[model samples]
Target: MTRKLHTLSTVTALFAGLATAHGLPATAEAAPTGQTVAAQDVSPSMLSAMQRDLGLSEEQIHRRLAFEATAARVELRLSQELGSTFGGAWLNEDGSQLIVGVTDEASAALVRLAGAEPRRVARSKAQLDRVMDELDRNAANASASSIHTWYVDLPTNSVVVTAADSVMSKFQAENFIARTSGAKDGTIRVVRSAEAPRPLYDTRGGDAYYPGNARCSIGFAVNGGFVTAGHCGGVGTTTSGHNRVAQGTVRGSSFPGNDYGWVQTNGSWASQPWVNNYAGGNDVVSGSSEAGIGASICRSGSTTGKRCGAIQAKNVTVNYSNGPVYGLTQTNVCAEGGDSGGSWLSGNQAQGVTSGGSGNCTSGGTTFFQPLNPILSVYGLSLTTNGGGGGGKGFVSRLNGKCIDVPNSNFSDGVQLQMWDCNGTNAQKFTWVGSTLQIGGKCVDVANASTANGTPIQLVSCNGNRAQDFVLSGAGDLVSYLANKCVDIKDVSSASGAKLHLWDCNGAANQKWDYR
Candidate 1:
């Protein structure tokens, strides 16, 4: 099951809805009204699970769950009045108290009426306070002697700390082991290393780039460049080859809030469909299709290199020391500092780019990556094929047969098209002869086959046009003609009037199309 940390403070009302669905009383049900009495009778198994997993004993579990039950009741009543406007609910880290965020004073009053101790604080203020507390705690600590940095797997919510030669480090490692005993876990030992923690970079010989890296495997190459993690390199940063040869420069970068970046290259380097050399074995290049939540995935990085694991969750928002990053996919795959910007693939289909993870390969950990589709659409680049062994014909045929009519109102000729129920119509029939798409016996050509959005798609009488042929390249962006340009939406949109236009395809969500 997928697990996410929801703030009881932000969604106190939502949980109240959940409680009511589960037959619990609303918050207005007072202590003497017997609701509290019912909550006090929580199941023993539930308490036991908390004790075993969270390290809470019976009494602690009882107190926390009882408090949660009361809070949940309060939330239910408030939510009915506030609906989607209700923010969220969360407990203090210690689990001793609860906080509920509301939209306004009136909403806060409703929360208070539901029995919660409502506090008025701006969202930014609350977030800043949390960051300051973390910063203060980190600053007050003078000794690295006793403190050892460990990696935590976001997918599993597990931690792994390396053992040091020092007695203190050894103690810390042992303590962690003991604390995590009797759970689904694994571990490995490695030599103690210093905590000179700097931002992990993909290094070639010597030169450095903020958000672009050299040693990492390219997700998929387009005509101009490729897309990877923004934390790898920032805008205008230059990249070089493994031998420090000039390669590309970062065109865009977004981090601490969104983990994505793209690099425009000088054509000295080319992208391939392959991921992971796998120690000289054949590499795996995945199709653009996304896998289900429980699907398996394998990662190839410069550090941990290669490891396989399962996806734990999608759309997870992680709070890192730098800032909060949203829309990251969490996996059990192991990774390290230099591994950022590596590729994550599922069954030879591209999945995403390595963003960050909490642990190393020695002990089990969780990691996250930026999904590749969005990165492609944002830049209008097409992914190169693995080893130049063009994709299988069967795959292409299947995609064509599944094409469904997307109303022109919903999508234009150049718009990134999605597959819906097939209705056996000319609009749904698309011929993928090579890399172009022919519709209605005419070429559905991008004006210049450019990757930019807002380039209108026009129907031209077919003449074996390259601009008409399209390929669903890496991460679901359609590549067209010899130009290597992609079918793009004028803008990243889902609205009816969003025109379908073509621009140089960079991997971005706006250009990623899904075939059902």
Candidate 2:
């Protein structure tokens, strides 16, 4: 028997549909129901898994992906255009249509014109967010052991307060809601739930590494390592692979308030941009674009392999036996112990890392995950996509201690490079992907592919050319592969805004670089 992986044929097809409808006019209309934008580029195994879990046929999956691609763009535009009046947006159960909520008729018309079905609601998303914030501020001291979770439900345009089934729990939930500052504004609704959420961790699994004596699955590979649930280990904790080989160390971690962590792997291990589908192949991770609520999602774990489901809610707060973890996305997927830190995907887009949930796979369950974007932001990490390298994202500082800056984050072709004081911004962040220095989806290239003594270094589109290949040699030199030349600061200036150029490799302090 072979294991199925989350692999795809080509990663580009996963998000190609998004580009079809980038901008919409005020009089635009939604895509017709059951109509696909183009041919679906999904694998047979993935299609089968989704069909079994979401109860949709191969044709339905294709249609849903196309509609969702357009809806994603519409949602982004309306959210920005209708700021305060925008309530929320979500897809129907089958994902054939997108429904947007608005507090005013004008916004409703805009939503309709933007290709999404618009519904009227009392409170806007901003108002509900404020109420949810208030609830979170008070939750630390609230007497609420029976509360399952609370989140902003897009369809209802209100904050949902899920309480346990006991009468005492209901009374406590009611009191908690009543005491909240904005709960009386009809922004809060209470629902009863019998399930309890907890962190999933076990001591046994095949595709998991040992953090201490506990096993957890790998989330997604970053530049220099992989991410997992923070509860698996603390800072400086060592990990071993499933085969008991020395793997990596926990360089960063955060739990309770937020469950996330990253492991800096040793040179013996190499990070890959694929997730195990456990059926037969690997699913290549192309990007981390977040999927909207009600979209089909799948999770890969050591214990359960791959499980498919739909996203139920976002910005959810789950109370566990240890403490409350906030900002989790709720789902209907089932996961078991040893599945913590596993990867979740919305189509080919990376969703998050599994945190915890309630129930089991045998009789259905509700799970939650820590969204991936925040994890990357917090750790200053860049995702390792297909054919990409892993070395993390940060300032590439030189001998003068200044960073290689992108000059206002402008990615225009032929924009010359400069060295400036590092302020920890995206302009100064660079990642190594297959020996090429990347920033803002562009590559640091040698101008005109010249081998002259003073050829200027510039930013250009990534074309896999020799002009774009660079590596940090063991001697601390930033060497360009074009002609084995070194990137040096012009005039050997230690001042800010010093321009960078290529020169013959020499053991000089001016040509030395460090990624920090």
Candidate 3:
């Protein structure tokens, strides 16, 4: 469920023949072909998940990746060429085309000649920056401001202001914006939002970091440390990792005016270049190449593990009751407590660090992130990449961090499995070779390869068929490739010798399996 699933404003219709277009629609990822799985060099886990959510074909997924990669380069080139006139850029609904925003006709012409559609906007991105600066200067006076945000919507060509309908009066908001130096008619427009945003900070969970007694998730690994939400800590604030080990201290931090901070790691902890998806793979960091608006994006945090959405707005300001944060990027990604300071990425590129937003994961919600470019530039830190890092074997265990096992170490085809203490035995290991869950290279199979519910589960030779395919869902349900039925606990048994079977996924403990 994606929260704040709102688009700034309607723009020109997307290219024809695309399945209906909408903002942050809840959908599943399609299973990628084996060829595409390799050709894209992405974790098959990631691709299959995206295919379920984004409704894209293997070729479309390939093109989206290729498009965003090339668009990053093109955007940088156009930024240099158009300089101050460059307004913004975005991906089309199908993600097959790109639109670059520029101020002047000359810049638009240049963009057209470069093979991208160009649109003229009233204000340049530089002008929007100036306006945002003015908003920051008025931050203190506007602390009690509306729904906590103002940003230039590339499509609307207006600085969109957000206020909670029940809190700040419309009159009060208008007067505040009118007083801001650069905000005038057609310059700033107010919109009502459902909830007031805040810096999502906590110390109650995984990837836990205790900075001033608050927990935060790692944003992304830089040179000496990782970056996170500024609200998580301040200069000299000592922090500890999930293991209760002294990990690092805040080297630089900021909030309200800016929502980013970086910590300097101690020798006890080694920073890795990849973010753990917890959905079955690690997303490698290749570069921080920016993805434009409407570009499909994903996020990783200790709480939700990995969830994705699209960038809804940028260069935005959110006026929290604590203060106001300027230059934050808003998204439809669902984030909850303990997810703040997590990483927002598109493909392998780093985009930003989680800041704050309203709502929850179960009911859907909105989130904001401190864009990475500003933090990197401000701190003079270079991003780390996966080329220098190695990942785990991608095998995981059941809840309690133990193994999903076959009792007695049986290699016979018909043995039922159970969850037991993991000792790193070969029987405890499982690999996703394509979509099959293989233990000792044998696929977890349905009895007689049938799709019927309550069928006994067993191990069989890899057949490259539906019986072998499985999906590791975000909810920890092992859904089958055949009938969409779940791998279930036989007769809802919890003790040893409880046989595993295929049944409906009813959200019961018997149906849930934890993976490390």
Index of the highest-lDDT prediction: 2
lDDT of 3 by residue, 1-516 (tens): 011111100011111101111111111123334322113355554566567667776666655765554444345445545677788777666665677888878777667655568888888877776776776667666645454677777777667777768544676677678877555546778888777787787722115677856677778776678888888888999988877788889999998778889988887777676777776557776556567787778877776667777788887778887777777888888888778888877776678898888887788888988888678667856566553322112223343344467778785777776666656555665543334566644678887878788897788766656676665554556767555567876776545556678987576767766543
- List ranges where model 1 is wrong by over 4 Å: 1-200, 203-217, 386-516
The C-alpha stretches of model 2 lying farther than 4 A from their native spots are: 1-41, 203-206, 391-516
Candidate 2 matches the true fold with a TM-score of 0.72
lDDT over C-alpha atoms for residue 360 of model 2: 84
Worst 10-residue lDDT window for candidate 2 reads 1-10
What does the lDDT read for residue 385 in candidate 1? Answer: 40
The C-alpha TM-scores of every prediction are 0.41, 0.72, 0.64
* Best model per TM-score: 2
Give one digit per residue, the lDDT tens place, for model 1 in 1-516: 011112233234334433443334333222233332222333333334335435655554444444454443343334334554454454444344445566467667656645455555343223322332332233223123433333322222223333346777667545434433311234322236443222345621011233333354455454466677776656898876555677888788888667777777776665554544445443534344454344445676666556666566565444455555656777767677777777766544567777776666787677777787566555544444432322211111132333334455233334444433445444554433222344443456756545454556666654545456454532455554333455555555444334456667576665666532
Please identify model 3 stretches exceeding 4 Å from their true place.
1-40, 83-85, 102-107, 166-168, 181-183, 203-206, 389-516
Judge candidate 2 at residue 152 and give its lDDT. Answer: 96
**Backbone clashes in each candidate structure, one number apiece?**
68, 18, 17
Global lDDT of each candidate: 0.49, 0.75, 0.66
